[model samples]
Target chain A: MPKSINPAIRDFLDGRIWLRLHTPFTIEDINQQIEAGHIEIIQGIESKLVFMNRKSYTCNRCENTDQSKFTIFNCAKCEASCAYCRNCIKMGRVASCTELIVWKGEQPIYPTSHTLAWEGTLTPRQQQASDDLTRSQEINRSHLIYAVCGSGKTEILFPPIFHLLKQGKRVCIAAPRVDVILELEPRLRVAFPQTEIESLYGGAKPTMKASQLVLATTHQLYRFQHAFDAIFVDEADAFPYKADETLQKAVRKAVKPTKPIHFVTATPSDKLLVEAKSTGGISIINRRYHGHDLPTPAYISLWKYEHHIQKGRLPKKLTDWTNERIKKSEPFLIFFHHIGFMEKAEPLFQLIHPGIHSVHAAHPDRKTYVQALRDKAIPGLLTTTILERGITIQNVQVAVIGAEQRIFDKAALIQIGGRVGRSSAFPTGDFTLFHNGITYAMDEAKSEILKLNKGGGTNPDELPFM
Target chain B: MNCLLCEQPKQSSPSWQSLIAIEKSTLICEDCSNQFKRVDIIEVGDNIDSITSIFTYNEAMRNYLHQYKFLQDIALAGVFSNELKQALSKKKAIIVPIPMHPTKKIERTFAQVDELLKAADVSFEDLLIKTNQEVMGEKTREERLSMSRLFQIKPQVEIESTTYILVDDIYTTGTTMQHAALTLKEAGAKTVHAVTLIRAASEQ
Candidate 1:
């Protein structure tokens, strides 16, 4: 008789497909599991990843199909010139010869009962969206929560997530940026107090316990296969996911076959809006939960701002904005298009105030700097679009330096504007667009905010500040 | 054509060498080639008779070796083909690539030294077989020196009483080359000289 497979190994590998040998699992246990016919060994780089006729390769895990991204190296294991996917090489090199182990045994049952510890009531707008999402899950159709920022989008997701958990189904909330995942983990855990929730991101330790609710970055979903019964993509139109097709494929590949992928975003792409409309349906919530308008952005023309910053001088208008914020003792964030320009302008901004700092995606102290800003320890920060979303600071004034740059698209600008007026205690703040010249994106972003604000209730002049 | 190292389109001005060698186009561009810090022939003393290295292990060479050996960008083996050919062709000694352990060979796919020689279109003798699986790069200088004999002469292979030049991808602490040379000397080789692509600045 075959020996029983190890429960620990099974739980770890249950839905995590395409794991390399000895990765977070002992080789002996994996081999034993294989002997018991509870594990399946699949080729790391499936033949489907390669285009035979074109002499190109793709990464099966990340769905990276770019011809340039696939590289060939002499593989000792296969004894051939095997192709490996460079796109997801950081996770582990996936070559033709590498064996990916997956658990095909009896899946461990998750707890169907869960407790939502959150006592806060959802607004009527949020309730409507929540009901719409729960209805979409019943019919097994994809849905989009086209809600404005600070509109309790996460609260809307709670009902559907709870419904899925009651059915003993696994649910995933994936975001493109790690910030979003970090932001959701604590909230989701508090809300689903008794549920097994795990947050997966870069460098995160893998949990041995079988988690029913998975909050992961889109990049982390590359390791999963047919894992979640329902996957909700939070910040669906965010960076990397919006610009990269492979990330889109990763999200699709992560979900179980025929399962729906609901999207929750403040500003989704036109393609996503259309896809949702044609499929499950779109549920729009234009109002913030606080019942206030999105902070309308005011334009400030700073022509040759780069030249002035390069010359070790902040532009006059930018200096004025900084002075005003400093005079009011308000914490601020100045967004730049490029890191080089941001760094060049960082010292100039610091001249106005010594504690002002700069941050980018790869900045080593990004977490601390953001935390420092949140704690109001620093006066301000000059940053790239990395801080465009998922960060909430009370009474934080915002500015976009070089707003005319192509990087400041309508979606990005809208999200940046969303950064302000988030918390109800500080309902309104200044949002300045410091631009060299006006661009169509700027006009679209301003009009989009105006349209959303109008859709929320009434004219900003008509409504009193909360 | 794309440059073998950078994979960028080859953009190089025609020099007198390129003009004469019309059939042998440069595999890597001038920009990529300029990064290597070529050094003069330095004699590696002790058990080995002498050693010759083409380039010092500068940043570019380090990156090149990382991509070539670790990342398995095998096309990079041709980046210095012409230089290797020019250096090895003048030597009267028999070319013997420092052998990889059978398991390491499998892990690395093609033997790095063998591919370098193959890319240069130079023939070599497979006279030695590596016996141990320990990688020289991972061990400290002292640990590597004290490690057990890692190479053995292949069965039935004759080590003629002539000079044998051993080829390797990089020369670090020279422990690997010493072990390889000692094995060859014991197998009746007269003189053992080492040729490596890059010489790392020894760790002080």
Candidate 2:
């Protein structure tokens, strides 16, 4: 018969069993056990309890063990090797087991549930895209997933990404805007519940360890050097990224040599498309996911907001449209070509309807104001083209002031229209271009949308829209 | 080190290593060195202040500047700062480098002179602020001269009879330094002397 164990030893063993066997443990239980002296406290260590199996007794270095004669040895070379009973030598470098070692204290761990599962069926176009991404991944070739506005491009990426993660391959999705990264983070986290997903942008919490998947803005790509196995450049032609060669260099530098880079955009630049075609790996999804055609833009003449402001009045058509939206409690965005004009028009519209909110790049609380717009807490938002892409607000009407301005290029106008009619709940909305005269870019943008709407097979002149 | 421009052997005078390379083929020999007195002019008005530079604007200097301005090479700024300190050793005046437009600085992620001055351990003050001017490359010498009038001292910053040493990377026609000095004088500065990395040789 085994000798009766001491009461202190029994309590210590019980405490160890309680900690190791049970997870999501309560602090009250821990405090009770600590007060009973069943736990040994180690100060200055991170407040965590470490449990070791007490039945194990083996020499740490040479893996020799004697279960009946257990002892902790103080050897000088113990720093390099944990010296324990002779049996531990056979176990090889195993440390001696202690019972109920409690850390000082710990931050509360909240259990998070990941339940992001695909609920929607893939449309025919999305199915085709899914097929293409699989083929592209198998062949190790670059593929362009060109989907129109409101076409669940992010959702389609989930299937391929899930496949890659299962195979233990790393994936990165890079965009030019912080807003896009913010929008994609929660969606990605839900889709890959067990996989570690890192969202890297300015102001995001740094991941404690390297992750299998990452969502980062293009600027953040500068820090990575040939790290990712697959790279997806979203909004490939967006400002500062497209205009600056150094950012492009950074992207190229970050991507591994063997990995292929996928470009996703509603409107591809002529150069990018030409390169994609020449490279022989291109896939385009012309139709939106909503099953409705993309909106064809039309121009209305309204030259310079400055002239209207100086006259101590808002433009007649714009004011009438804005007042109707305000009366109906519908949220809307009025985009101006220039910041100066946007600033001038914002106050005039607010005076006409005091409930309306306006925001621009210079606003200190731009993020908060934009969130308010998204939540429909405000009726209207007056803005610059900074809100053109990477932001989604439900049931908002969009109008571009001074659409004929040189700054309002084809791609920009299309992206501004994309801001409207994004959600299935509010699938259709007005997208008007207020201009003194329709410019070539305006005509080009309208035609491009029409072409994309009609199955996208017209030999349209290649313009640098994206 | 050799003179980067003329390929002549550069000898450091007893004072500082940087002064010998400021201008092309223009070195104050040991005998003529006594004639060089530390000028305490607070404001650069009508008279031209003779300046000394440490290095010529050679390929290495251009590469260094390219890294400093475009690549955000913070480490290279340390070299620049040490060179500036050696060149302006005698001057007890506060060092003031030209200010960059806030917008440009934001885009570039750093101010060129701020990095240099911080690395060099010299006291810097915003004595002169840059104003809206045409692109430096697009403007002619006359245009640049007219445009230089825009650099002015802020009203709150009172430079009361204090000497200032103007620091800059390259001194081409001396238009920028001249305007800066004039503005400093207008703000009640006692004297202003210029020091740059390079000064183009005067045609004989």
User: Tens-digit lDDT track for model 1 on A224-295?
Assistant: 988889999999999788887888888888898889899999888878776876774678887889999999
Q: Candidate 2, residues A217-249: lDDT per residue as tens digits?
A: 876665455566688888888876787554576
State each model's CA lDDT, in order: 0.84, 0.65
DockQ of 1: 0.35
- Give the alpha carbon lDDT tens digit for every residue of B56-168 in model 1: 98888877877778766666788888888887887799999998888778866778888899888999999899888876778786787778888899999999889999998
List the candidate 1 regions with Cα displacement exceeding 4 Å: A3-5, A48-59, A456-466, B1-98, B110-128, B136-143, B152-172, B181-204
Q: What share of the true interface contacts does each candidate keep?
A: 0.46, 0.00
lDDT of 2 at A459: 27
Error of 1 at A20 (Å): 5.7
* Model 2 CA RMSD to the hidden true structure, in angstroms: 22.5
Give the lDDT of residue B184 in candidate 2.
82
